[model samples]
Target: MTTEFLSLLCLGLCLSYEDDKENERLSKPSLHAWPSLVAEVKSNVTLKCRAHSQNVTFTLRKVNDSAYQREQSSAGDEAEFPFTDLKPEDAGRYFCAYKTTVSHEWSESSQHVQLVVTDKHNELEAPSMKTVPHVCNPRTAGR
Candidate 1:
C-alpha cells in the first residue's frame, strides 16, 4: 500500500510541473522581427524592432546575459537603436522586445546581425611591390 501511495504522489508532482511549464510558455513574449545589416568602420548601425500591438515598447540586448536596453516608440510600430562608432566588440547577436500594458507586459524577438567593422585601409589591398615594373639588363634580355 505504501508503494501505491508513493506512485500516486509522483504522478501528482509530475502533473504540477507540467502545468507550471505550460504557464511559463503562455506568458512568453513574442518579437515582431529582427533586422540585418552590414556596415563599415566609424559608421552607425541601426537595430530596428517592430511589434504587432499599438501599445508596445522596445528593448535591446546583447547575446550575453547582460540587462536589456529599453526605448520608446512613437507609434509602437518600430524602434531603432543607433550603434555609433561601431567596433568589433559590438559584433554579436542582438534582440528586441516590446511592452503592451502599462504594467509592462512585453513581447520579444531576436536576430543575429554580425557587426563587421571593416577598416577602409584593410579593404584596400597593398600594392605588391614585387609585381611592379622592373628594369631588365640588356645583356640578360639577350640570354
Candidate 2:
C-alpha cells in the first residue's frame, strides 16, 4: 500500500472511534424520583438525573411548562432537583436531558417520569360523628 493510502486509512479509523464515543455520550440519561412517584401535598420530594457520561449538566423539564431547572453533575454523573412543600399544581410529567461540558450539546430527552401529587385528606376515611342528648328545655334559659 502507498504511504498516503495508509495515512488516510488511519485517519478514517480515528474519526470513526471519535464518532462512536460522542454517540455514546449523547445517549439519554436515566431519571428517578425519590420517596415515590406518588406523593402527598406539602411533602418534600427529590428528582434525580443520572448520566452515563462524566462532566455533564443535567436539565429537568416539566411537560408543557416553560421553566426548566439545571444542575451540574457532582462526582461526575448525577444531579438532583429537590421540590419542597409540594403542591397539587406540581404534579405532572417530567423529563431529563444531559449535555457534556466539552460539546455543549444536549442529548435526547429521557423517558417521561410522572409525578402524582395527592392531598393528604384523600388518603383518609371520613370521620364518624355521634349524636348527643339534650338535657335542658328551650324555654328555661329565657327566664
Candidate 3:
C-alpha cells in the first residue's frame, strides 16, 4: 500500500510539472526585415513578425520609443509591417511581439533588427547593371 501511494504521488508531481510548463509564457516571435538591413531613402522594406500561432495580434516597436509603431491582427502565422518611402527618421532598431487576441499577456519581444538609412540624394543607375536600374542604383548598389 505504501508503494502504491508513493507511485500515485509521483504521478501527481509529474502532472503538476506538466501544468507548470503549459502555463509558461508564449514563445518569442521571429522578426526580420526584407531585402536587407540597410535601406536607402525613398526605398521600401517590410518588417515581418512570425509567431507560433495564428489569430494573434502583432506589435512593432522601435527601440528607445515608449509606444508601439504599429499593431495588427493577423489571421495567418505572420504579420507584415511595410515601411514605404523610407526616411532617415525611420532608420532605427526595431523589435516585434505578439499575443493571442483573447489573452492580455504579450509574448516576449523579438530580436531587434536595425534599419540603416542612407542620404536622400537623387539615385543614379549603375553603369553595369541597367536592367533594374531604378531599384539597384549607383548609390545603393555598393551597399
Candidate 4:
C-alpha cells in the first residue's frame, strides 16, 4: 500500500509540472500592427507601423516607385517616417511595412497616405476690405 501511494503522488507531481509548462506557453500573446499613412507636406510626418515581435525591420516606400527607406524602431516595435522639406514633386502615395525577425512575417500595410504637396505660393488668399467698427448710439436706441 505504501508503494502504491508513493506512485500516485509522483504522478500528481508530474501532471502539475506539465500543467505549469502548458500555462507558460499559453501566456505568450501574439503581436502585430497594420501600417498607417499620414498626409503631410514635407517637414516630418510620422508614418506609424507596428510589429508583433521584437527586432522588427520597418520600411517605407514611395508609392510612385521610389527607393525604399528602412526605419528601425529603437523606441519599441513601432516606427515612423519623417519626410523633410516637402516639395510639390514629392507628393505621392506612401506605404509602411514591417517584418519581425522572430516570426519572419510582415504585417499588412497601413492605409495608403496620399501626400498632396501644393506650392506655398499657389496656396494664396484673396484680398479683403476691412470693415469699420461703429460705436453703439444709446440715444438712437429709443428712436
Candidate 5:
C-alpha cells in the first residue's frame, strides 16, 4: 500500500508540471503600436507583435476582416507590420496570434487594440472652431 501511494503521488506531480508547461505554451502574445495609438492621416504607423516563445509565426488581423497578415521570425520573437499613408478607413481594431512551427498549433489570441486616425490639420485647430480659423486670428472668436 505504501509503494502504491508513492507511485500515485509521483504521477500527480508529473501531471501538474505538464499542465503548467502547457499553460505557458498556450499563453498569448502581446500587441503594441509605435509612436502612439492615435495617428494622423497620411502618417506612418507600425504595429508590433511579440511572443514569449521563439521560432514562431506571428499573425496580425483586423477585426471583422477575413484577411490575415503573417510573419515568421527565426532570430527573435517579434514581428512588425507597418502602415504607410494612413487614412480614415484604416482606423479599426486589430489582434495578434502566434503559432509554433513544429507543433503548428496557435496560441490564444491577444487583446484587441484600436487604431484611430484623425486629420493632422484639424487636430491642431481649436476645439471650439466651427469654421476654419483665419490665418491672422488664432482663436475662433473672429470667425
Candidate 6:
C-alpha cells in the first residue's frame, strides 16, 4: 500500500531530525563583567563571554530591551564588549549566546550579569560622621 509506505517514511524522518538535534546541542557560555559589576556614571566596563569552542561569534543583549544588542566574533573562546561613558540608562541585566564556526546552531544564552550604575553627585554620606579642620604638630610621649 503506497499510503502505508508514505506514513512510515514520514515517521522515520521525524525520528532522524530529533536525534540530530539532541546529538548537536551546544553548551551554554558564561557571561561576566570585568573590573566590577557596579559602575559609576561616566565609567567603563567590559562584558566577557566564554564558550567551549574557538572561532565563535558572541552576541550580547539587555534583558527585556529590544533596542540594545551587540555582536562580536572571537578567535579564542572569550569575547569582550566594552561600554564607556556609562549612564543610568545603561544599567540593566544582560546575557550572551554564541555560535561556533562549525555549527549553525547557537548555544543557549549565558547566565544573566547585572550592571548597576550610580551618579557621583548623588552619592550617600554617613549620618553619624563629622569632619573638623585642625593644625597640629606631633609631640613626644613625655611632653
Best by the lDDT measure: 6
Worst 10 residues of 2 by lDDT: 122-131
Q: Sorted on lDDT, highest at the top, how do the candidates line up?
A: 6, 3, 2, 5, 1, 4
Q: At residue 85, give the lDDT of candidate 2.
A: 95
lDDT of 2 by residue, 61-132 (tens): 999988655555665788889999999999999999988865557888999999999886865654356558
Which residue runs of candidate 3 sit more than 4 Å off their true CA positions? 1-22, 120-143
Better of 4 and 5 by TM-score: 5
Rank list by TM-score: 6, 2, 3, 5, 1, 4
Of 2 and 3, which scores higher on lDDT?
3
Q: Write the per-residue lDDT of candidate 4 for residues 1-143, one digit (tens) a residue.
A: 99999999999999988666444321122222222232334444455555554566776667767665555654466665655666666677766766654334455665676766654444455325667889789988868
Which runs of model 4 end up more than 4 angstroms from their true locations?
A: 1-42, 52-54, 125-143
lDDT-best of 1 and 5:
5
Candidate 1 global lDDT: 0.62
Displacement of residue 3 (Cα, Å) in model 2 is: 17
Pitting candidate 1 against candidate 3, the one with the higher TM-score is 3
- Reference-based TM-score, model 1: 0.54
Q: Is candidate 5 or candidate 6 better by lDDT?
A: 6
What is the C-alpha lDDT profile of model 6 across 1-143, one tens digit per residue?
A: 99999999999999888777556878999999989999999999999999998988999999999989899999999999998999899999999999976667778999999999988667764434676767565674456
* Model 2 misplaced regions, further than 4 Å: 1-25, 73-75, 123-143
CA lDDT of every candidate: 0.62, 0.84, 0.86, 0.57, 0.83, 0.89
Off by over 4 Å in 1: 1-36, 65-68, 123-143
TM-score, structure 5 vs. true: 0.66
lDDT of 2 at 129: 60
Taking the tens digit of each residue's C-alpha lDDT, what string does model 5 give over 83-104?
Answer: 8999998899999988765545
Candidate 6's TM-score reads 0.70
Global Cα RMSD, each model = 9.9, 9.3, 11.3, 10.9, 7.8, 8.3
TM-score of each: 0.54, 0.67, 0.67, 0.49, 0.66, 0.70
Candidate 1, residue 133: the lDDT equals 72
